[model samples]
Target: MDRHDQVLEVWREFIATGKISNEKILSPAIMNSWKRSRECGVDPYQKKVPVILKEHKLKNLLERNKDLIEICRPFIDNLYSFFRGTGFVAALADVDGYVIDVTGDKEVLEMTSRGSFVTGALWSEDVAGTNMIPIVLRENKPCQLRSTEHYCWSQHRMSGVGAPISNPAGQMLGVLVIFGPYEKANPHTLGMVVAATHAINNYFHVRRMLTESQISNKFQKTVIESIPEALIAVSNEGYIALANENARKRLSLPENITGKQIRDVIEPGNGNFLSIISSKNNIMDMEVQIIQDRKPKHYLLTCNPILDAEDNPTGKIIILIEIVRARTLVNRMIGAQAKFSFKDVAGNHPRALETISLAKRAARTLSNVLLLGESGTGKNIFAQAIHNESNRAKGPFVSINCAAIPRELIASELFGYSEGAFTGSKRGGNQGKFELSDGGTLCLDEIGEMPLDLQTTLLSVIEDKSIVRIGGREVVPVDVRIIATTNKNLKEEVKKGNFREDLYYRLNVFTIEMVPLREMKSDIALLARYFADKMSARFGDELIRIDDDVISILTNHSWPGNVRELQNVIERSISVSLTNVIAVDDLPPEIRKKPAAIERDVSLKAMERQLLLELMQSKLSKTEIARKLNVTRCTLYRKLKVYGIPYQ
Candidate 1:
């Protein structure tokens, strides 16, 4: 007999005798499926599929598998076109074996409908018996079941080929099936289904990859924009690729700066962008300038090259920090910030208070201030207090001692020098006190001591509110408030042609005369206790008590070094005093003197000897000692001889 008749005969025997007597007539996969179907209690005589799903449940199943059905729609139509005139039905089934979609010739569709082989019908082996859909879904591979190979009698006259539609990982998502009359059974049908499944899987993979790429790009953009510093990305070809908000604002660039040339947007202070791209080297804290309103704005720039797998430059990433902000951080790192305010200037004397009050008023304005005082009279203290109390209190307080820096180097120290400006100038140039003190205060200590030539530059910078570095032509703008302090009377120095008369008058607009300790004797006791308390806190000890005698002796002395000398004495006393109470001996030897009772009882000749001893032990020169003693050099020599004192 024919193969179909032989398969039918075997099926009948297996159903009636519950065993395959002619197992050789059946393939291993078909025979195994037959055994499983029988174990599931499937009726071999059933006329139709027994597991048709309800309408609502089938609708829900189709909704869940919408993507699969949509992706497979064109492929299914194309596959069916090869057998359009033939009696074939193409259908898609979910992993659960429920048919979700179907297309077929009208006549074959009608015949399959009668067997419950249409959409929404379950076609698994347990319910429909040894069909291609269930076999392929279970095996996760393609299969063809023809004629009596089907375990159920209703499906014996039909044949179907099915292949699994799976993800890239090879896990089955569903099956694609083509059913035809028993005469049309062919192994080639399985090949067609598998080819379509592959096409669907490729499309699915591309769609997933595109989605993930979009997500990653968005995340990177968010991170770049969140940074506080200006950020930019540029292609190696010099085109701007990306710029964060801060970058656009800082560079004064348009909102849509992408595709613009890098040179058109930025001006490098060192070299051209092309050279930088060709070098492919990282740049750190390189100075650069961007022009806005015909004036250049400075920034500290950092650049890192983006490299490909071969380590070749693909692009670059850049970060920009405004020069003012950068200098502020540098000032903090170098201890250039002010630490005193108006309240730290200790004194209740009217002259002292008046000077402080005038300084406060000067702090409120933008004019230059000049502090006149003797050495150690707290002129620098007033400068610091004015800086902390000014509008630029939060900014840097850079100070340079005009008398301390050598005359040869003071120009570069005050106005800075360009790279290679001098034999030993630094690379990338240097920021002078003016640039470093931008938006802050600059205390030019001992201004009268500045060289005559440099004083002209200072006057010009003060008047123009800008400066040019040595050997550099660019005029950098500065907003520094100058507080020039000097012990030498600037007026006298100007009369002697030792200082620039024009510079003196320019800085003398708001002058404060720091009161000396000798002139403010009434405040000595108060200032001593203040220093004592401050020292005690610093040394982690109880405040030292200043005895009345100690204060009296300090009050009587002429403090040529002024308030600074008093502070040093107080600190010294606190350091050496065995007890918390400071006494007359705690005073420096030069400051000590006999009391009123001793002065009255002592002989004039003996007192002169004691006075000479004190002056000799101090740092005073012979001329200064003679002046202090109100004696001519000739008479002072005679006195030193009578007292048996040696002279240099």
Candidate 2:
């Protein structure tokens, strides 16, 4: 029989017997496909191919596999070009055997369209019965099928070659198939399909690797940008590769400084990153200087080398911290913060209350403040209280005593000098109180003792809101609030040419006069108790109590040293006292011997009567009073009874 009659005979035998014993008549691949088709119950006589997906479903499927379609489109078009007039059609199908793309000549397209072999057609074994697309998908290998090898009778006139397309993981993604009339089939067509499928799989692998690399680069950039310290990464040749936000601001670098030489952006100085790179040694905490806004500023630099897999240095990562910021942190660690507030100023006397009220008002503004009072009258306390109550409370509170720092160094101490500006100047210079107290308060204690020459510079700094160091020409701007304290009257000093008149008016913009302990005698008792309790804790004793007699003596004495002196007396009394109650005899001789001023008056008899009446109201026993007055207990009781003071 001829080929056509033989194909018909084989189909009839498989339908009737469910087996094929003719191995020489058909290849092993075809015989196996025939067995699978029979077990699946496909009818060899079935003619019409069922629609697998309607228009909308087909559109959705194509959209879902858009990447695969895109990757296979040009290859399919090339395959069609190779067989342009040969009546061949090249098609691509997913692993499920649904044709997602097709390209072919008009006549071949029309011929396949009739049998639903066009795009969106289902060609699986269960649907189309052992076609090339289904067999290739099942075996995940390349194969060719001709004429009667197809199980369905309708596909007996077609021959096709198919190859599986797989991802990098070796799992089959789809199949590439070229189908045409059996008369046009070539032996090398299946090899071409196999080669094209590998090219498609390679494209998938490369595209996935590129996508993952882009994602990883973006994540690394994000992490670098989130760091707070100024960070710069440079190539081994010293060209910048990356920089963080703080690095941009601190170095005043322009955006997109990448690939620019590091030396071009940061002026070379101590801890030069390029030098460190040459040495190939990691350096840390190296002080350096950079010129920012035409002014020299200091920074602490740390650099670490980036090494390649071979352990050779490839790049460097540099970290920069502003020196002023480091000093501010150090100051905080050393208790350079305001610890007192208005509530800690223990007094309700009218003068004290008025001073507190004025300070509170001063805290609301950014004006300079001048605290005028005798030493130990809480001038420093009021300054700190104002700072803690102000909007800048969270910032540092730097106090520098003008009298403590020598006149020759006061200028350099207030406005830092540059390197080589003076003998013994620290390397990279120093940031003075003004720079250290940026965005905070700087208390210039004992402003009266400031030299007349320095006072002139102070006036200019206050007027211009900037300062030039003693030997430096660069103008450094400061945003510090000036809080000057002095025991001497600045207005009087200005007249005597000891202080500048312009600076006096500037600092006196908001003046607060602290009340001395003697002037606020009513608060003396409360202050004594407060100090006693504080000292008791320091002495590791029970909270000390002040007797009424001791209070009376404290109220009567002339406290020349103000609150500070009173605190010392309380601490001393607590240290020496035999009991927790501070008594008249526990007091220092200087305090005890200093009798009430009224006792030395010419009207001694009246003063004595007033003293007796005052002592009578106290909680002190008669014996304590006798010891305090330097008289016998019998005399104390007789005098109190004579003054008509109650014995109780």
Candidate 3:
């Protein structure tokens, strides 16, 4: 239908509903805004419909310039609604010319279309010519034209008025033209077009702001992706919505993590930690370690809420920064403060207790004592027990592992060193263990491995009760007790020409030897319980116990590596065992290969007697057997009588 016919059709539909009890229908004018709704849908201006029948056409021209037809629809709807009786919006060419958006009164609109009166028809001096809409648009103002004003004698039968809309920034939209059967000029009607354009200008201002907001969101996403930190954005419900590339890489997420629950991405424990974070609580600077694929990693996760314009939290922002390293745990043992007294050293075995008692007795003197033991045979413990009982217990107990130091530097390590002794050395002179340990005890661990040159220097220091700096000539007097320990036999090293026999004799003030863990089978369960409780407290885990089968397995092992190996096994068991009770399955593979528990129970003396008898049966001379036993002939006979082995 043409513009006039469609107006009549909507009129019939509205009248047919007949409930018509609403307020008197509004008169046709620009502010009705009927055309506004269709801008998002179809276009009707330069394409769909006419202009005088529309409102806000000028506003559409400036901001909606890309889709003029669609933009004019709503403005046209507004104008058609202004007057109830048949009406149409028309776009005029120049004063003598065509029409653009025309509606209402079917027969009237079609005649207007066929008559070359709108849209493509010229509405300015350069075209079909002399129309108010184009001329006013050219002049940047509002104007009116009646049928008589038409410059062409043949086109004098139409009348319309048009106004141009301006933006907040004061730029022209397009010309809005309204027309109907030629009527006497109503100046008030023209005022309505001007008023409608102002409304349109306000709409453009609002749209510009919305467009700016979209641009800002784009910039925010760019910034998040570019920053170094892994940023995770979550909703109030704890669901992931945005995770940047860094976060995805750090967390090792395979797919887009958006919409995943927070529980699924971080460590299992970290989910609980996040709950606490959302609760607004924190354990600041606490080290949180995460182990992934057997490699330990650390991260510091800090959380805060995302706020809205209202200053209320809408969600949370979790920022993850990788921790380079937590501080490496220092070797914390009882020796640090000499807290172990003889009372804590348990050994019901007669020889063991006798050795402990002898150590206590020896602690009271200024003797240079040596301890022999395999690693983790409680050698350090015995050393601490002696230091605590000693008269010099109030002083620091300095410990240095001679074998652990490089061969080239063991001498300087034990003696004082002057400034500039070597590159990367301390700026000023450094006091060695001997000087630092004055009035205290100095423990030389793995002492048998000390270089021959360092041994000579140490031998002189002990004999003269003084030490010289590595780079200085002056000798310094010092007072200290020495506790040297090693797993190697000094006699074997002497025979091998690797140790000084004279120095060993000079330092053999008192000797204590620790039994290896396997030989002390009676104490395995006791020590296991002790370590379990202590480790539980240290790691904040539940205390674990060894099953009867595991204890049985422990007793059967050869334990050639001694107590140090025992500790390692127990630590590995604790790490791999998920239950509170450790079973034999948790033991190392070597332990599984050992003989039955009862098969390994022979006493040390009994085993020694058996070995000696076997050697005697070979008719080996007393000296040869004694050498094999690491003792002299006299000691061997005394041991043979003690074991009641008659050597006929």
In order of listing, the candidates' clash counts read: 0, 0, 53
lDDT score of residue 495 within candidate 1 = 91
Best candidate (score: TM-score): 1
What TM-score does prediction 3 earn? 0.40
Model 2: how far residue 29 lies from native, Å? 62
Candidate 3 least-lDDT 10 residues? 325-334
Q: Give the per-residue lDDT digits (tens) of candidate 2, residues 1-648.
A: 987667668777877887655557877767787887787777777775675698799899898889889999988887777889998889999978889988888877888888888778888887678789888987788988887778988887889999999888898889999988887789989888988998898898998899889998998888778776799989888899899988998888889899998777764453444565456667676666667776667677788999899988889899988876887786788687999998888887988888888999999998999999999999998999999999989888999999999778888888988768878877556778888788889999999999888888888888888988767777778888999999997888888888878778889999888877888999999899989977767655567789887899899989999999999999877655444577665678789753464234354446667777777678887788777776555545545655566788
lDDT, candidate 1, equals: 0.83
Estimate the TM-score for candidate 1: 0.56
Candidates 2 and 3 compared by lDDT, better number = 2
Off by over 4 Å in 1: 1-223, 235-242, 252-278, 291-295, 307-314, 592-648
lDDT winner between candidates 1 and 3: 1
Per-residue CA lDDT of candidate 1, range 361-388, in tens? 9989888899998899888888998888
Mark the regions of model 2 whose C-alpha exceeds 4 Å error after superposition.
Answer: 1-227, 233-236, 239-299, 303-317, 538-540, 593-648
lDDT of 1 at 225: 90
Give the TM-score ranking, best first: 1, 2, 3
